[model samples]
Target chain A: MDLTFTDAEDGFRAEARSWLEANVPAKPLPSGDTAEGFARHLDWERSLFEARWSVVSWPERYGGRDASLWEWLVFEEEYSRVGAPQRVTQNGIFLLAPTVFEFGTPEQQDRILPRMAAAEDLWCQGWSEPDAGSDLAGIKSRAVRDEAAGGWRVTGQKTWTTRGAFCTHLFGLFRTDPDAERHRGMSYLLIPLKAEGVTVRGVGRLDGDEGFAEVFFEDVFVPDADVLGGVNEGWGVAMATTSSERGLTLRSPGRFTAACDRLVDLCHRQGAVASDPRLRDDVAQAWMDAEAYRLFTLRDITDMVEGRSLGARSSLNKVWWSELDVRLHEAALELLGPLAELDGDAPAAIDGGAWMKGYQFSLSGPIYAGTNEIQRNVIAERLLGLPRK
Target chain B: MRFAFTDDQLLFRDTVRDLLDKECQPEHVRFAWVDGDGRLPQLWQSLGEMGVLGVQAPDAHGGLGLSELDLVLLLEETGRAGLPDPIVETAAVAVPLLAEVAPPELQAAWLPGLVGGGSLVTTQLGGPLVACADTADLVLAVRAEQVVAVPRAALRLERQPSVDGSRRLFRVDWQDDDAVVLAAGSVAADSRDRAHDRGAVATAAQLLGLGARMLDMTVDYVQERRQFGVPIGSFQAVKHHLADAMLQLEFARPVVYAAAWALATGDPDASRAASHAKAAASDAARFVGRQALQCHGAIGYTVEYDLHLYLKRAWALSATWGDAAFHRRRVAEFVLGPPDLPDRPSRSEEIHHG
Candidate 1:
């Protein structure tokens, strides 16, 4: 096994490191889940797009460098190492872009991708509803074909939509054939939030940010051209998106490794190695878990490079990283002690309350992207070949 | 970068696995439990003939001159078989240590015999108990930070029985006066530290195999063993437990493989990587052993059953080199700098007060 990167890849990493070192803001940006923060993040994203750093894995025609997946991973490592702002455009580029690359027509790609890379068309997922959180196939949102209007008449209410109020569009599955089975007859639609009869209300998350929203659609008109994959093939298409969300695309190993380095720094600051053996061990264990995740991803992407399918193995990645994130944050909070409760703006708050805010966000990890319970079932049934019953 | 074994490496692994499947089945393991010193001579000879014993030895010593990456999977196969031998102690740790640092006269005396199954060599790297020291032709013991190689006839061995009966642990009585000094001062310390890392990583690979084997056995048992008029595997609790076990193994395996790579390449972070692998693999195998027994119910609790063989082996090996906590603490020292000692405050203190 050759673990060394090529000279070209190392050069790519050097370029990314230098760019990020110079470009990333000295002070951390506000959380992009908020209105003001969202606007600020758009500026950052536009700078990235202008420099062809926003979507490095995408084609050059779409403002990308046409980098390999390994290079993209390198970019992520360098990006996080410099403490860059979180990608406010992740839902568009990480989750949906893969599905679009696989399913979108050339016309769709040409029209949607460049704008997406430029952060002109912000997007949020609309999968989870009030009643269909885990059982996503039980969605009751309906879309009726309107031949006269040359599109679909969509009526639905989607809840727990992350950054919905900040986004310009929604991508989700809606039932087109009501008489069909649960996973059948659903069409994946991309609906404009500014369309007539559409409404969005921002909801405060546990972290006290309007990071989530409820989007209501009342007979909104969507064009037939916005239908991704096929009219009755939304479930299959959406599964591909979920796997990307669950796998390396959304949560790169660089995020955790950087977090691990930060944790080590915090431990050093707190004199944790001298003060508490248990806490020191916990910090080290968390750091090792992050490294393990990195190693696991290298092996995973290597297999992909070798023409092997990720398949249900993405479930393993989902469960692992989500859980590791929570543990990492927990270790930080433990080091922070009672001061962890203070908010970012509070006087004497530790690291601007980043640990507490991150802990709150990490809670959503296991809950979103399919609950860990559901992922475990998928692992047992699909990967281990156990009986579903 | 490719992060997988080469085709030849995988083929060698499969060859050893197939050989173990035929010769070192559960009965072979059980037979060793009832025999003296628990040494499977024929299997050992076959592995020697396959060049498994000589994987890290130089070609001039009638060996394969391979690195740990080439030998890592073979260690896993041995773990899967619960093979009643000291292959890890002899082949993985001692042979390589001897090849790399032993004096020319000592190498000529032991290297060829050790490679060809004519002699056994075991080292006491740490702790009081030495694995297979009772039967080893040479016992490489550390005396006051110096490595001394002593023949078995010069030492006294008192067997210390292990929970895994196939493994014969012992407390050896030896002296530096009667032994030849292989290395002294800083060189000996470095050799001893390197040997510890090798043993830890080798055991980590074996733990992965043991975990996988137990998980497979439990999965097979649960499918046929029924409760409530259906297969036990149909229960969600059973499925989730097994799933969690599989998850642990899945994540741990890659770490062990990477540790092997780190050692083979002599990476500066090899010690930390080895500790990481041992900590992860020990936890995964122990967790899988618990869940595997729980899923199997009463049948798995019996020694007559084969699952206990792998479970006990995992438990024994989990604590062999250094348990999960020890390795984590070692990694903690690496990542956070050494712990704060009042007498000698290191980089940790600088970071703390700086």
Candidate 2:
């Protein structure tokens, strides 16, 4: 059980560290939820694409270095440490890109991935609907065949569409055969947001930002060629995306460890909390949790590389990181005493009140990808073989 | 960078598991309370014959010379089986300490015997309490900055019966100029810290196994035990309880494994890693144990069932080397700052959920 990196991995880390140090934005980018912020973040992603730093783990043909999992981890470590702008195209680069590489036809991969990698086009998820959030199989979104137009007309509404207002494309589930059973007869489709009869209205999030949108598809035509993983098997295809969403592609342990470092630095800044014995251990545990996640991810990567099937355990990873993210941010607030309540722009706000913004952001972790409660149910029924209700 | 066990290590774990499965069943564990000395002597002997007792001893001592990582699964299996013996204290704690610090003649006299099952060895670590001191042939202990091997005959034991019927703890009162000093100054201090770390990591691993056992048992119970005209496992509350337990155990495992590896490799972060393992596993075990029993309802409370074994073992093991709070304090010292301030439970809980 070797934990240290090899020379090659060390060199990769060094190269990443150097490149990030040199080119990363000197100040934090604006929240990508805003139009101006989104554009700037997109430009940051384009620069990363030029340097092949955007998707280091992907194969070179997909505009990546084709790096090993270890190197990929190293890259993530550096990426988070530099406080780089959040990946504005994560919906495309992480969730849909993996699906495209795995299940997309060569034409789809050829047309979609490079542009996605370069952030020329942004993507958003279309799985959740007005009535179907946790119970996704209950989605009533329908797409009927248009044989003459050689496609399907999709009609439905998808809510909680993250960054949907700015995204140009979406990948979502559509009920292809109305007569089919639950979780069946569904097809995954890639549709342009600007398609005829489609409208996206931005939804304000907890931080009063439009990080998400409500996308309505009214007889929007999606080409048959855009169907993923074949027809009536969108459930299986979406499962792949969910796995990536909950696992390495979406959330990296490095992000949490970096938060831990910042939390530690925050505690160091607040000399007042030093006398509180309880907070001291709480502070220590924050770091321990971060390190634990790091080691856990390495173990996961090792198991994956060794041909071990990554299974329902991703639910466990999701719960661990989501809770850690929330608790870590909370710990920062607790250590900050009264200052934690300040707005980020407040004159007396600590760390620019990033912790306050982060706390609200962290709550979204438990709610997104899949709720922690749902993940717990999955762990119980699927992993533990408990009887389902 | 492999994180999984080697095939040989896995085989060792399987062998220990097979042994525990056969010999450490409830019938045998019950014997500790019914007829025996609260020690599974036969399983202890068999572990010795299999060289499991010497897994961490050096090769020169007629042992396996394995590191903590290799022995971690074995210890975990022992915990899973609710093995009532000083297996961890003998192999992971005492033997390693003596092998690393004992004088040559002292080592020759006791190391092989300790490893080969001819004798038992235990330690008084972390606290003044000496577990299994009465049953041990030799005891590794510390006085000031010196580490000494005190013979069992030199010490008087006051028995401390625990809620966990499987374990027998004792306070060792000793007077011993005849004790053999193994190392002094920084070496002794190092050996002392190493022993404590090993004990903490081993205890953490055992707690993990105990938590896992409880979780698996609770899952089985919830599946068969019906309420409201359906299996209770179908209930969201029951499922969530068990699921929460599973989450703690699952996440704590990597920390335990990583700590074992850190101590084994003598990494710079070994101290913090050991504390991390102890803190995480302790919290997980306590959480899982309580939740498991709660899910089992009244049946889990009765001693007629085997649930008490893992639950009691969890309680016993969690406070063995260091409890969650204690280890967390240690972790705080290393990463946060001084941990010597008086603990305020109310404020602690507030900060805990804060």
Candidate 3:
């Protein structure tokens, strides 16, 4: 119940803050527009990995300090306070790493976790297909067994694969049995993007960045050892992955706090509408929402540490914080005013119009992981005990 | 760092809960609302006898010297029982403030009676409008730079029956030279802040109790009421609504507890935490009350039913101390700094979204 840190925690906070102050780059990683810019961001992520501060929560065997959740929270708070680069390996480190630890074979954990921790093996999610966005159980992509080849041939199209262009690996779901029930026959697989049959096509966003890609797999052979958990248990694995994704990674308030701080600074530096009451209120509300989300996350983490299951309550957190992130970024745009329209090279370009880009980017937040509508349904049914439709 | 009750505190909570369960049933509350003085005299006496009223006051002042957390637990159970009394007003409000600021003579005179449940006292909170002033034994009236204590008999009471059937509002006037002035000047603001913090936490505890009861009532009703040849509780819609209410209540409870912890532990940000608790609890109470009534269908609205009593209490308690909007604004002031005309955009021009 106490929000203030204890003396020991305060000492750790001081240490973390000093380290972050000394090490955090003076400028943000170059905006992920050009391939070179994206690569530089990856390099910065690798630097954090080299420093052993990349994934603050992972065990030492996996290249982290094996810090307590409280310590991890403090690390995030310090990292955000200093405007450190957002974790570029978030998809691999935050989402898949936890899934692999829980369900992957020991060998799988050993092989993948270090690479993930080191940012050596950048990863992209292949969960959402064109038709199976919110209803992931409806995925039609198939991975048929090639017993003679000691593998399965995965053939499917995954749309909205974030950062798919530069990623080396894809952890995804595919239908293993065509005739089985929609959710039951799926199998989770880890496929190398460099495999001969895989192809990635860039998808241009409104901001004109190819941050998302459509990954196509044609008879892409994935070894049987790469299968996560047991066959036909992909639904459960996907649920685990989705829960972690939706609950923890997608709505990390620490990240939002940093962004809010940056937005406030941008407003101060840009000297346009810095004193706008409406904009200030928007920013203030965003900050408050972020704080609330942080407290809620702490409560969830406390529950987890105490062996209590989050269950559907995580959906409430997901819905709440996702909307907050969207609103916060949208506030940044309003603060920018006409400057939002300028991108890249315009004289009025504000941080390459990152606020505008983020506003557009935030739109997909509620759409992905699970649509906000679906989340509401989850809250209503699972949390609220409503009748099924 | 521990967010749980101590063993003694747990026992105290259980004792109060069991006592109220046995004595202050909703049926009793309903009866008292219609026939008696809307006061549970026996229940109050039972609490006083159990020494619950003295749980948070100093031992030197005829009290137990318990923590704010202990008081919150008691208040929460009282709220859950729907026991209509001045436990909060007399114990939480008047006793604590009097212990802190009252003249030595006043403290000696009032502390023993309040702890013994021999006298009831309430404050005249000058909210957006100052309506309630008459029913109190002593009024904690706020002037520009001072909070003066005036006897209730000296002021006039303008009876205003609220949505909450158990409590009434009053308007009073006071011009007595003998009236006690507790904290004055800068001390007044500090005392007001402390009282506001305590009021916010207490209100949150009360809301938690009311919200929990509404949830329980809704679930029980849904379980019994048949729809389409089955209990409506079996319906996912009803279940989900109840689950959502449960979520709100669960979330708000911890925040309220946290606020109480902050206050007891002397945390620097106790004010902010208290405001957070108030805002969260106020929202939960409103949401849970409406949902409870909705789930119970037509029977919930009837005066004969006990559900309305819980609803009335929720409404009244929410407006007490401060409402959700008021707390939100207070929280906003803390986080965003006070509204500056030249520094922020006008409210109308802001993009509004939920």
lDDT of 3 by residue, B1-354 (tens): 445566788898999999999999988887766753567777777888788888777788779987787799999998999877766666776678888888888888888877877766777542422323443467776655577787766775556677776665655566757367788888987887787778778878999999999997887788789879888877656765665677677667777888888898888888888888888898899899988998899999898788888998899888777777667666656665555456655321221100
Native RMSD of candidate 3 (Å): 4.5
The estimated TM-scores of all candidates read: 0.97, 0.97, 0.89
Runs off by more than 4 Å, candidate 3 = A179-181, A260-284, A334-345, A349-352, B1-15, B103-105, B126-136, B215-254, B288-307, B341-354
Candidate order by decreasing DockQ? 1, 2, 3
Q: lDDT order of candidates, best first?
A: 1, 2, 3
TM-score (0 to 1) of chain B, per candidate? 0.95, 0.94, 0.92
Q: Candidate 1 overall Cα lDDT vs. reference?
A: 0.90
- The 10 consecutive residues of candidate 2 chain B with the worst lDDT sum are B345-354
| Tens digit per residue, CA lDDT, model 1, A157-251 | 99999999999998999999999998998989998899998999999999988999999999999899999999989999999999999999999
Candidate with maximal lDDT: 1
Name the 10 consecutive residues with the lowest summed lDDT in model 2 chain A. A272-281
Better of 2 and 3 by lDDT: 2
lDDT of 3 by residue, A105-159 (tens): 9999999999888888988899999998888888989999899998798888999
Worst 10 residues of 1 chain B by lDDT: B345-354
The stretch of ten residues in a row with the least summed lDDT in candidate 3 chain B is: B345-354
